[model samples]
Target chain A: MANQPISEPAQKFGERVRARRHELGLSQEQLADKAGLHWTFVGQVERGRRNISLHNLLKLATGLEIDPAELVRGLRRPTG
Target chain B: MANQPISEPAQKFGERVRARRHELGLSQEQLADKAGLHWTFVGQVERGRRNISLHNLLKLATGLEIDPAELVRGLRRPTG
Candidate 1:
């Protein structure tokens, strides 16, 4: 309830990570390994089915080889 | 160091957050309260002293009432 906005940004962050992975031509398995996350969790996040913790987000950032700040930015209200 | 890139981006992220807090006219103590972080840690982060975790970043985002994605983007390679 209190974290509603957090959830939206959290899920949106997943979208950003998935997009970056695809853009870099990396698969979920590869990214999972690189980021030290479970392969299933990677898929879960990408599909917006998982609520990832901060540790996992850090792992995802490490796996994507992108700045964690970028992941934070990716959750923004994109100016359409 | 192994985490060199992460560290650089991590520090850069601190700069972004610090800028945001200053722009919002929030003191470290106030921001810390909003973000649920220790006041000392907030100070450390703004000064690029302590290495923050992803969880803290999320808290910071909430405190600033901005998208976490924006924080992530803040770590981008400025096109200057």
Candidate 2:
């Protein structure tokens, strides 16, 4: 596990969003609407370009029909 | 109850950190050093004045010697 390439936590977070959105068969626009966030903001989040706040994290979790922790799972220390 | 006073999630997050830090007998400066973060950043986070990112969240969790999820538990829907 230590040998795994280090990935930014933001990238992992974005991947989770993409995976969950696909699992729910929801487009970015649909997810954005449900989360009450802008589509561009969703894009930024999904691209790991935004340092999303706790409120937005909760909104996204609610939109994804999951707990907030679920969105943050599997985030291990980044390797060198 | 539904009448519970609405509190921002950031405040709740900060409260958790404060509570946990006290429980662990660690000062903010100590925790900041352990988390490899600035002491001022730790203070800001504890005050709910910072929109902390996932990376920082993990660092805080590590510093607290707790799971990242633990830091976020009990965060309910903000009552309005």
Report lDDT per candidate: 0.69, 0.77
lDDT of 2 by residue, B1-80 (tens): 43232347777788888899999999999999988889888887888776677778888888888877776664554544
Candidate 2 lDDT, tens digit per residue, A3-79? Answer: 23235777788888989999999999999999888988888788877667777788888788888888776565444
Off by over 4 Å in 2: A1-7, A77-80, B1-7, B74-80
TM-score of chain B of each: 0.76, 0.82
Worst 10 residues of 2 chain A by lDDT: A1-10
State the TM-score for model 2. Answer: 0.80
Native contact fraction (fnat) of model 2: 0.23
Per-residue alpha-carbon lDDT of candidate 1 for residues A1-80, written as tens digits (9 for 90 to 100): 43242355556767888899998899999988887778987887876665564446667877787776677663432221
lDDT of 1 by residue, B2-79 (tens): 324235555676788899999999999999998787888787776655455445666788888887767665243322
Clash counts per candidate, in order, are 11, 0
Kindly report which residue stretches of model 1 are placed more than 4 angstroms away from their true locations once superposed: A1-27, A32-80, B1-6, B74-80
